[model samples]
Target: MKKDENLKKVAIAAPQLHRHKVKLKIGNWKKHFDFNYVNTIIALALNDFDDKIFFYINGYLITSNNLYLVVQTTEKSAEEMVTKIENQIINLLKTNPQKLKENRSEVSIIADDENLFYAARKPLFKIYPLENDHLIKLITGQKVTLPYFDRDLEHLKNRIRNHPFCSAINYLGGIGPVKVTLFKDQIDPEI
Candidate 1:
């Protein structure tokens, strides 16, 4: 798949510019679902939402890594953005060809600026309720500061590339060693 020149720039600017982030857990990683298909639908919906908003696979989590769509909003509140995004995704899924089930999603705020996915910060272990189920156990079981590891961005990109859906769509910037996909509002949008 050919890379869109405009989107390339958005990918680079995503981490630093998009401060207000909302992590979306569309489906369960433990259970089987057409990831590419679902993500494509979600991506299309996001593309229709806003151009500056960015989307990516939360591959940092060691478990239950779900699709994360982060929107950079200057006017709208985070709660409002999350609700709109969820609603947009739901509306799109209504016409899905395969009757995609499991709409139970966890949408929350990434309050940490040191987060790898949200910020240009080093890819480290930042626990979220949806992805890391054993976070509480990790906190209680260990005495140290959760043993956070400094993950290489390249390594994370490689891991994402290995996924079967890496080459699924151009919008999925994870395709072939990329990080995130920015659906520019000015582009040939979808929903």
Candidate 2:
């Protein structure tokens, strides 16, 4: 089989599949762009876990990750697209058992926007762990605190940055967004 064909097959077989929708109020162009760039980086990194990504944008559902990526700019700006993608990726990493080992994972979103003679960029990164006391507190509606680890955060940032897919997205000037929520189970009304 051809290399591209083989990759296609592998992509189809990967796990971590889910669908998501999001809407955001837009204000500043640069801020929005930075947000989107980070979102894209996170999405690219999630592909490292071999998940089949799907996104719903302006009522349109995109299936193929690659195609979804290509069309990300149609409904939203380049930055917005990146942010959505990263949010999805972080959601996946937080939920997928196979990907979540020792209760920790990290993802980074980088935004690169350049003017005629000047360039500016920023990275938004997130770190998740099984022992995320803050997250637990939020979910459980309780108060809790845990020691923060700078080295661990750095390690996670490096892992996502060095990911093969993330590298490509960054090169394309995409930035990821910081995720506020992770995995959620569907509520069944019939229950």
Candidate 3:
């Protein structure tokens, strides 16, 4: 086999996870997201890729009929990745005999970025392991406004900074996540 001139392997320092905002909508407003099925599909899909696909999984939300996930992963064509995961979810829902009565999910990819910041009550971060050693503590601010919060208009950004990346995101609803700077050593210099 000939060596590929375009490819160069880099060691891991910190995983520069891009934020992918995905909303999985059940056709019927009365139905809930098939949690087990969603997990199963994503797990199965990730199994096929040896590269680290996810970095920080901020968490997910279940509105009346939709499941919203805020995921951070290495930037390897995030839209394509989400589409692949969604297709797998659709197949899983269609194949399950028990789920035949339900309609398939409408998975939508909202945004992809490495600089997205998210804030919630200090008491409610139960699902994501924010303290994981692999995750670098970028910023921690208080009182930022997000629809995800109980109130409106008056929100605080914990340790927030203004970065061009903050404005480039097209799908964070109206609420913005805090922006943090990465150290020179964090990103691969050659990349």
Better of 1 and 3 by TM-score: 1
- Model 1 clash count equals 0
Which residue ranges in model 3 land beyond 4 Å of their true spot? 1-15, 22-52, 76-78, 102-191
Which prediction has the highest TM-score against the true structure? 1
Model 1 lDDT per residue over 81-128, tens place: 555555665555444434222444633332331231222111212323
TM-score for each of the candidates: 0.38, 0.20, 0.33
lDDT leader: 1
Query: Total backbone clashes of model 2?
Result: 21
Candidate 3 versus the native: TM-score? Answer: 0.33
177 in model 2: Cα distance from truth in Å? 23
Q: List model 3 lDDT by residue over 43-110, tens digit each.
A: 44333443444544343333333433445567555455456555544444344422321247554321
